[model samples]
Target: MIKVLIADDQELIRQSLQIVLNSRQDMTVTDVAADGQEVIRCVRKNVPDVILMDVRMPKMDGVQCTKIIKESYPQIKIIILTTFDDDEYVYNALKYGASGYMLKGVSMDELVGAITTVYNGWAMINPDIAAKVLRFFSQMAQADDTISVREKDMEELTRTEWKIIAQVEKGASNKEIAKNLNLSEGTVRNYLSTILNKLDLRDRTQLAIWAVQTNVRKRVET
Candidate 1:
């Protein structure tokens, strides 16, 4: 079962998430916290597999909480739940190793799917905010022209892997990539894993940034 910790200042939101998540047979709401400090306490007592973190909580905010938790318990996956307007917070959360980001208005089904996806070691970004994330990374990549792509790294990837990277740069999900490439989802995931390892990237977010930096997507498109 995937253990979950919900951290939100709003009691209604916390209780609602607890009820909805606990109803799932595959997941359990292990604990709830009203602030970042309590979240740290709860985590120390019983580490959860996933944390649904609210961005604007009193005391310490979710971004700082994410940084702290990930620094100590790197295995714990965190999904930042916030409004779309909190673009800076979302970017910082991702930089601090948050595994996923979801808008607070996401449906229970989408939340559950995101939780499962992150628990399985994949990153998830809500579609609505994906473009913003891409833009943020693209700008960052442009600012850091020193970030070089070694010729050897380009030569190391197979043609199929390059295609997968192109799809990822376009913000295609694993399922979408699989369908587009006529491959199974599992195969696509495996390819992603291999690609990350070969490129020394931490996750798909970094890979996407690298793709933009290297003009891999543009090259493939043309």
Candidate 2:
């Protein structure tokens, strides 16, 4: 089961999210925190597999919390949740190692899928926010050049592993990856763990960013 932590200052939001997430047999909300400082304390105690972080919180904001959490506990996945769509906030959150980002209005099913998707080592961004991110990158590319690691690291992937990586780049869940690859879910998980090790990456955030940076999808197109 995937252990999750809910960190939103709003009591109703936290309780509602907890209720919805608890209904999933494969996931459980292991703890809840009201602020970033509480987030740090709760994480130290439980070490959850995923953290649903709210952007605007007392004491410390989500981006700063994400930086600290990722720096100290690289294994734990973080997904930023907020009502705001500020580009700077989203960019900083991703730069600091958040694996996923979504608006608070996201449906319960999408939220659950995102949690599981990130837990299994993949990155996710809401389609609306993804468009913004793409636009930001487009403008930034015209201003300055950036060098990124090539996805050729993925060429080292086995034929089966390659299939898994392709689906992950598409933001598919492990179950979805299993369906597409005709492999068991456990096999998909194993492939992801191997992929991370082979790439010498920290987690799915690095993998996804590297995929886009290296144009892994385009390489496959060719």
**Leading candidate by TM-score:** 1
Report the lDDT of model 2 for residue 153. 68
Candidate 1 residue runs with Cα over 4 Å from true position: 144-150
Candidate 2's C-alpha runs over 4 A off are 138-147, 150-222
For model 1, residues 1-222, the per-residue Cα lDDT tens digits are: 999999999999999999999898999998999999999999999899999999998899999999999999999999999897888898888878898989988899999999999998889988777878878778777684324556787789998999999998877888889999999999999999999888777788778778877778777768
TM-score of every model versus the real structure: 0.92, 0.72
Residue 2 accuracy (lDDT) in model 1: 100
C-alpha lDDT of residue 197 in model 1:
82
> Among all windows of ten consecutive residues in candidate 1, which has the lowest summed lDDT?
142-151
Pairs of residues clashing in candidate 2: none
Instruction: Give the Cα error of residue 170 in candidate 1, in Å.
Output: 1.6
